[model samples]
Target: MSANAEDKLVIMNEEELKRKQREKLKKLQATGGNPRPARTLFLFNLKNPFRKACTSIVEWKTFKIIILLTIFANCIALAVFLPMPEEDSNNTNINLESLEYIFLIIFTLECFLKIVAYGLVFHEGAYLRNCWNILDFVIVFMGLFTFALDTINKIAGVPPPAPAVAARVTSQPDPAVRRKRRPIPLIPSVREADSEV
Candidate 1:
């Protein structure tokens, strides 16, 4: 209404705005200044510990394929190995061992990528809370434990028997691996044979 009253109102508004900004700045500073933004699954970046590329073979899609394949292969191996009624208790299958090694290599690459992605910022609590991240770590750790056990057993002059090879043959191919396999040639002989049958 009056010019003086208008001027006072504008000043009050500006002061309130400034106060709010100051409070926001103070809260930010108290939290160690500019908190890092939360990571999204699809739009992973260098700051995300779960997505750093550790090896030429360890890209995002490659890692995903590896994880899926590992699950499938492990399930198949377990099924094949578990049902066997081997006469000898000491006879163990080697298929499981090879699968385990493959899993270990993938996991090692994963963990290495994670370390590179996070660099020096990796926190144990954060690492534990992430699902895929934690699973990768666990897989690698279990492989390492198995390796240690095998090595110790060897050193004690009592090497464990190799697992049966059947598991390896029966294990399902990783989708990626299956795709890489050469497609069978469609020979006329095969076609004729099929037609006859």
Candidate 2:
């Protein structure tokens, strides 16, 4: 083809590339994602051991399984801790406060592990930016708040100190009667009153 046609062809290719870029930007905006995703380093970096281990196939599988188990455990704990209806009439079998605590610990650890793997910025819809991550964070925060409230309630519910016992009052014998019965001696018996006998 002639040089002019070749130049036209090259311009058309450039236009096509620009069009694709524009579409990409639009798509990113629509999805609430950054068109130009930010890059971060440190623990989340590819070379970091945390990121490496987390992303590894075997490790990821184990991590996922553990997370799933924790969720299941949480369900069981929830069922156990839920108050029974009046109709059920004291049929509750288990007290799951301890289980719930275990679930919270496991859930918290899972979230922390994910954050450690994905980095804290959560830019590009990763880490804290992801919906799942946000939900986990909120849940953990609420759990902490609930724990605080529980502690406060426990402290407040404690019985107040018992009131002091009342002291009994007795009538004293008449001083005149005692003096008459003792009879005053001219010399003080054994005990001297100062120097004057």
TM-score of each: 0.43, 0.48
Worst 10 residues of 2 by lDDT: 161-170
Best by lDDT: 2
Deviation (Å) of 46 in candidate 1? 7.1
Deviation in angstroms for 108 in model 1? 2.3
The top-ranked prediction according to TM-score is 2
lDDT by residue (tens digit), candidate 2, 1-197: 69999999999999999999999888777645633233333434545565556446324777789888888877776666545433232334444655567778877777666665555664454567777778889999899888888788788996433233111112344678778888866866465665556
* Model 2 alpha-carbon drift over 4 Å, by segment: 1-59, 80-94, 152-197
Q: How many steric clashes does model 2 contain?
A: 0
